[model samples]
Target: MALKDEKVTLAHGGGGKAMRDLIEEVFTSVFRPDGMEDQARLQAAALADPGARLAFTTDGFVVDPLEFPGGDIGTLAVCGTVNDLAVGGARPLWLSAGFIIEEGLDLALLRRVVASMAAEAEKAGVRIVTGDTKVVGRGMADKLFITTSGIGVIPPGRDLQAANIRPGDVAIVNGVLGDHGAAIMAARGEMALSAEIASDCQGLGHLMEAVLAVAPGLRAARDATRGGVAAVLNEMAAAAGVAIEIDEAALPLRAEVRGLCEILGLDPLYLANEGTLVLFVPEHEVAAALAAMRATEAGQGAVAIGRVVPGEAGRVSMRSAFGGLRIVDMLVGEQLPRIC
Candidate 1:
C-alpha cells in the first residue's frame, strides 16, 4: 500500500497524489531548514530569477551506458546545463529536471542517479527544485534519460556574445581535450589502449569565477562538448562572421586520450570534452584569461589555441607545428553520436 525506502514504484513518478507524497517525504526531507542554510534554502526555494536579466538554457543527457568513470548521467545532466550558462558568462543559479525512465529499471540505480544529481547540484551551487518523471516500456527507451533546464544571471558591465567576436581576437581552451569522448569509448570497450582515458566530466563554476576575476570583459565563450573545440569555434566564427585559426600544437590534448584516438584512427581535435571551455576574447585580454583559467582545477592545461581572421567566417583552419595548414571542417553529423 506504501512506497518503501530503497524501493521506488510507478507511483513515485506518477502525476497523481502519490507523486506529491513522494516529493514531500523524500525530496523535502533532504533540504529542510535543519540542513546547510544556503543549500537548504536553495533546495526548498521556488524558481525566481536572481538577476535583473537572466540567461536560460536547457539540455538533455542520454549518454550510452548512463554511467561512466568520471560521472554518470545525473552529474552530466547537471554539468551540461550549468556549463551552458557559465560559458555564456552567467552565474548559474537554478535547474529543473525531467526524467524518463524505462520500465523494469532497477530502483537502486535510479536512486543512485538522483543522489548523484543532488550532490552535483550542491557543488555547482544550483538547486533542482522542480521536476517531473515518467515511465515507458523497457524496450521503448534507454535505461534512463535526464533533461535539465538552467537559469543564470549575467554580471554587470561585462557583455559577452558570439556577435562580439572580431579579427585578431584570440581563442583559448580552459584545459585538455577529448577526455570525455575517450573515456566514454573506453567505458564501452570501443578501443584497447595501454593507457586509461577517463571522461573529463566536471563542474566549471570555480573555473568560471577565476576567468572573470581577471578578464572580466570577454567577447564570447562556449563549452566544447559534443562537437569538441573545432566545431564550437566554427559556430562562434560563423555566428560572428569571422574566420577562426587555431594552432594545432596549441590545442592541449592529454597523452593517454591522444594515444587512444590515434590507435582508433580518431582525430583528437574532433573528440568531445565535458570539462573544457573554448573562449574567444580580445588579444589584450588573452593573457589575463589564460592566467585566470589556469587558476582553477578545470583549467590546469589551459592554452591559447587560435585566433579570429577576416575571411571564411564560418570556416576553421588548423596550422601545423611544422608550418603546414589545413581546413578544419565541421563534422557531417555527430562524431560520438550519443555522447552527452
Candidate 2:
C-alpha cells in the first residue's frame, strides 16, 4: 500500500505523490474507472436511440456522524444521486464523486466510505467514472463530505413527470416512512433516546425499473427525501393542479418511528427518508403497479396510500383514522437538519 499514514494530512491534497497514492489506493482502485483522465470518456447504446433523452442530477451529502445505522455518508451519496435520476424514469448509468476530507481524519475510515460507494454503485448498475478528492484543515470540515453527480438515459416514450398526474390517479409508496429521520435522531444521542430503528437507505433504480415494466402508464414518482412523503405529495398536487387525499390508516410506518414522533411532538409526515418513493399510476394500472413494486427488493412494502381527486387545486389532505379530513400542507420549516 502506498498510503503508509494512518491519518490524512494536507500533503495528500497538494497534488504530489501523496495525492496520487491516496487516490490510487483509496478511491480509484475500488471504483476502477476506465482511465485517470480529467474527464470520463463515455458511450452508451441508450444514448444512440433516436428519441432517448439524457438525465443528469447532482447532490451533496453532509449527514452528520458520518456513519449511521444502515448506511453512512458514502451510501447516502451514491443512492441519493441514483434515486434522483430513477424517479425521473431514467436508467442511472454513471456517477462522479467528489470528496472533501478533514485533516487528521483516519485513513481507514476514508477507505471504508470509498468502498461503500463502490459497492452501492455496482449494486445500482452504475459506474463511478470520475471524482476528485481534497483535504482540509481539521476544523475546516466534518470528517468528510461527499458530492455526487449522476447521468442516466431516459428512454423514448417515457415522459414521467408530476404534471402528468390527474384526478383518479392512485398514489402509492414503496415502504415505511420516517425510519431514516428517526434513525439519525437516535444516532445523534443528543435527545437521550434509544431505538433499534435502522435508516431506510437503499437505491431505487431497480425498483423503479420493475414498476415501469408492468405499469407503462406510471404517471410520476418522487423520492421522499428531506420533507418525507408530505412534501412530495404537495409538489405533485401543485404541478398537476389537482388535490391529493391520503388515508391515514393506509400509511406504512414503523412502530418505533411513530412512537418517536409522538414523544417528540413531531409529525412523521415531515420526517426524511432515503429509499422511500411516492408514485402515481392510473386506476386501471394500480394493481399492476403495486404488484410490480412489491416484487422488487427495494419496494417490498409497496401499498396504495392515496389518490388524486377533483377538488381545490394544489390541495393535499389526509383522511384520519377517525374519518375526519385535514389538510396535509407543505412542510413549513426544517423538521430535521443534516438528515440526508
Candidate 3:
C-alpha cells in the first residue's frame, strides 16, 4: 500500500511495487482517465476526418516556490502546453505529463500539484492520457519539475503561420502583458517593493475557438511567453521578412506592472506572460476579429496595437507617443531564469 502520510522517497521511483502503489493512489486517482495502456491508441476513423490536421507541442515548467499568485507550477504546465496548440489554431485534445521530484518532499504537495493539473486539463477540454514520474535525491533535483506534451486537431484550411503575415495586416493582443513575470518576481521576494500583480495563468483554448469561429482568415497567432511580445514580434518579422511597427500609446499595460518594470530597470516588452496572445490579421478582418475576441471573458481587453509595414526586412520598430521611433530588439540573455 502507498504511504498516505509519508514524504516521497527514492523507492517510489524504483519501478517496483512502491512505484505502482504511488501511481495508482495519486495520479491515477486524480486523472481517472478512461484507458491505461502502454500507449494511447486513437481510432483510425477519427484521424481520417476530412480537413483534420494534428498539432503537437511540449513544454517544461520549473517555477521556483512551486506555487504563486493566481497559479502554481501545475497550472502553468497544463496551460503552457495548451496555449502552444491553441496559437496554432488547433483544438487541444490529449496530454501527457512527466514529473521529476526531489525525494523527501511532502506527499501532500505532490497531491496538490497533480490535482491542479487535472483541473486545468478539464478546463481546457483535454485529457491527461498518459504520464511518468521519477524521484531523485533531495539535492539532486528541485522540489518538483513538470513537463507536459499535448496534441490538438486543426480544421481544414485553417493554416496559420508567420509566413502568411502580409503588409497592412493588423496586430492585436487579447489582453494586458507582463502580469505573469511581474507576479513571479514579486513572489520571489528578491525585490523590496510589492505590487498587486498576479500571474495571468489560464487556458486560452476557448478564447481561440471563439476568435477562429468569427475570423477564419487569421494570418498567424503567437503566445507571448518567454521574452514576451518583443521576442514574438521579432521572430515574425524575421520569418516573413517584413517589418512590424507597434504604437507605444496603444500597448495594454497595467499601472502596477509599468511601475514595477521602471523600478526594476526592466522592459515590460521583455517580460513574460502566460495567458496573452499576439494575433495577426488583414486590416479588412481586424474589426471582426476584435469583436469575436471581446465576446470571450478571457479576451475582454482585446485591442489593436499596431500594423505590419514595409521597411527593412526582419525589423520591428515602435512608434513612440512623442512621434519618435525606437527599435524593439530580442533579449540577449535570460532576464528571469526558470520563469516558465
Q: Among these predicted structures, which one has the highest lDDT?
A: 2
Candidate 2 clash pair list? none
lDDT of 3 at 206: 95
Summarize candidate 3's per-residue lDDT along 149-202 as a digit string, tens digits: 999988778898999999999999999999999999988888776686889998
Higher-ranked by TM-score: 1 or 2: 2
Candidate 3 or 2, higher lDDT:
2
Provide TM-scores for the models: 0.88, 0.99, 0.97
- In model 2, the Cα lDDT at residue 149 comes to 99
Task: List, residue by residue over 288-325, the lDDT tens digit for candidate 1.
Answer: 88888777778878888889876765888989999998
State the C-alpha lDDT per candidate: 0.79, 0.95, 0.90
Alpha-carbon lDDT of model 1? 0.79
Model 2 lDDT per residue over 1-340, tens place: 7789999999999999999999999999999999899999999999999999999999999998788999999999999999999999999999999999999989999988999999999999999999999999989998899999999999999999999998899999999999999999999999999888999999999999999999999999999999999999999999999999999999999999999999999999999999999999999999998998888899899999999988999999999999999999988979889987
Q: List the residue pairs that clash in candidate 1.
A: 242-313
In candidate 3, how many Å is residue 173 off?
Answer: 0.5
Candidate 3 segments exceeding 4 Å error: 44-46
